[model samples]
Target: MNESKPLVEGAHFPLALSRPDLIPAARYSDPDFFALERDHLWTRTWQMACRLEEIPRVGDWVEYECLGRSVLVARVGEEELRGYHNACRHRGTQLGVGRGHSPNGFTCPFHGWCWNLDGSNRAVFAPEVFDPALLEPEALRLAEVRVETWGGCAWINFDDRAPPLRASLEPFATYHDALGVDRMHAESWFETIVPANWKLVAEAFMEGYHAEQTHPQLLARSAKSGYSAGTDPLGFVDPEDIVGSSLYFMRTLSEGMGGGMVHARDIEVAEELVRMDLPDDPVEALSEWTTRLNDEIRSRASAEGADMPDLNALLSSGHIHSVNFCFPHFWYLPVYGNAASYRIRPISPEETRFEVWTTTLWPAGDQASTPREPTRRPHDDPNWGEVLRQDFANLPRLQRGVRSPGFDAMRLARGVEGTIANFHQALDGFLAEREHADLLPALHGVSGPIDAPIRDLGL
Candidate 1:
């Protein structure tokens, strides 16, 4: 790994230091920094290209585009998938545009060059039209991109020398596996373009510190005692009526976020918990209520053959996170048996393409029919649930504010904002082109959910 360089004055996008708490302002708005990420981070990191369900059958394919490159991921055999650069070897024409089923194989629209499902050259349009050297079998084969599957998605890495996806994703993979994340599938998908740097947009969802102010509807207020400074912002339930307060909390959270954090069935389980006889002490009652609620939710889902994981076990093991961040550009909030996931991509220094998916477990074969394409909308559209609309309102303004001359670096909360800090630190390693062995430990530190003070990542 490169030694920590002293922060030089007037440097363009200087690399971050060993401390994972502060971030330079220029990293978010500078074109040169974005170019560095395009060349190093995006190309080397393992990124989710598409869900495995999207290409379940042989010959099924989807085109994934990033920066200016397009890759086609296709199922070639009953249990095998392959990825290839989307361009044809002949004339450099794109062979696929979007999701498709090519039972016969891909044929170039510009010319008559064709490639089989396994990325082997099938046939040339005419033998006499090209030089013999150009038609050599090895030269005509499609170029392959590295691909692997995990958590039900196909992840691709442009760098052939990059470590295997599982090895790079350490403790994060272990946690998600404990939660049965591989059994989950998208229930709804949506996309929008936000006028904000990709990191700015992603950082907005990395912490819960903004929830009390930005999403007032999600706040709990006492029914009898009314609002008071002593009231906990995290929970507003009145001690006198534990049942009513618990019900209100669950319903508001489920509705305000549009059913991703808490599913409809989870609400039903909470209602049943409220009716049972319990202790008179409000604190004890709340504790018992929470434990039973979690247990019942899992048992019911399992009884219905939903392949649900042991929520109580995961919680006791500390594997469950309200928000888990996979370094580079992915985050997911898992609650009950449902989860809400976010992915962001840079379009420019001030613009990003963001996507959200509401995911949950279903019967074995039921997820095959879920929609593969996200419904595109403008960032300001109100139809994005109450919680998200409130969150989106601040993105563009934050992007503009970061560029002010008087503003300097971001001051992140040591405890709540550790994910954001860890992200930038790991990014700096990539921009510096550090050795893979040195980078893996830092990547593991940045991989899991964040809710505590900054950790010594061994940078």
Candidate 2:
């Protein structure tokens, strides 16, 4: 956080890349692609590690799981952050567990191989047992990993000459910076052991085409009020209309949901009731009629003899999730205009963990105060939690479907398929370059070293 120092870069570099959209059907279940990604892709990239609040003091540290490797990030000094292999510098034993402060630097319980927060080798137990010259600081500091911070988050990379974070994030930096999100303390996070590859889960959120059938609660109650998602240039929009279009309907929920949501007019009354409760006039403030709209979708589905999924309970329970997939795994779902942050990390090809936190920025005065025990969600509230039991419950089953011998491929929507295509392309690019080393020199448009930005921090 010291402004005067040279901005830091991660410790690694890119080894390869793939064309974003043209992944083979076999990659999903192929053990070969899985192994390559674990080694070349995940290991080399600078990844979002942990939120700033997770470690707020000197010697603070947290363990992160990436691919199959376990790593640790530590706050060793007032402004300097360090990363280690999470293994003892001595006999390669695992270091600290969970998250907490380590004021005395890191001392391995096994054989007392100690590390300074700055990652220098401070001491070794039983000095007489080892040669004095070899154990000195120059020779024995714990191996350092690369680290950086943006938007109050710290990221780390394991490569020694890794590309700069800013460069890799260049295309999306403006949007990333515009997110006025600080770290949020998650109230609850739901984890489902999906049977599908990590890519499948990412694809599910990348596009909204599946909402009509997969998310009746979201589509029926909130789709009309501009049910939309911001897309990267990679977004796939189906050109064909009515028969099958891929555009996500720009949407938001009317700031309320309840039994009254069964009808559209009642939702309007509820919004009025909410507006009256607030001190400011709701007419001028940014607002929408999401909660005020409803289609007789359930009855229509029934009349058309559609075998409704068991999601009637969730739709009737009046819960709506305004989730934004912040490209890759950052699912930004805020609630009631409060603060929340969600990130999913891949543990392996088929398993990923979700980290959800609810936090609101207190803009330093009475105006920034957030309501405690929030009970409702606005479509635009980025701080809301994605209980997501309804969303993630079927993933494992879907994963299993991909594994079925009879199923080789599934269709994607045209208008809404952009993210899905982009994700596949990104994944393919990552996997392709990793496997084919010769392609590196030919990567014309995107390959460049980005230096850490040197900016005035107003010292």
Q: Which candidate number has the best TM-score?
A: 1
**Tens digit of lDDT per residue, candidate 1, span 1-459?**
013552221122454453466676777898988899899788899888888878878999999888887899998898888899988898789999989999678999886888888888998988797789888888888999998988778888899988999888777787777767788977778899999999899888778788778976665556655552322433434334666666776787777666677877788888777678767765676667677888898888888788888777787888557788888887768888788888888889889999888788744344445667889989899788778888889998998888989777788899988878877777777877777777788889888876645666565
Instruction: State the weakest 10-residue window (summed lDDT) of model 1.
Output: 1-10
Tell me how far the alpha carbon of residue 107 in candidate 2 is from the true structure, in angstroms, after superposition: 0.9
> Mind giving the per-residue lDDT tens digits that candidate 2 earns over 62-179?
8876775667888877887877778886788877776768888888887877877777777888878887776777767777778887655788877766566555544344332333
TM-score of 1: 0.92
Candidate 1 wrong stretches, greater than 4 Å: 1-19, 220-222, 225-240, 364-369
lDDT of 2: 0.49
lDDT of 1 at 108: 94
> What are the lDDT figures for the candidates, one per model?
0.78, 0.49
Models 1 onward score TM values of 0.92, 0.64
Give the CA lDDT, 0 to 100, for residue 387 in model 2. Answer: 23
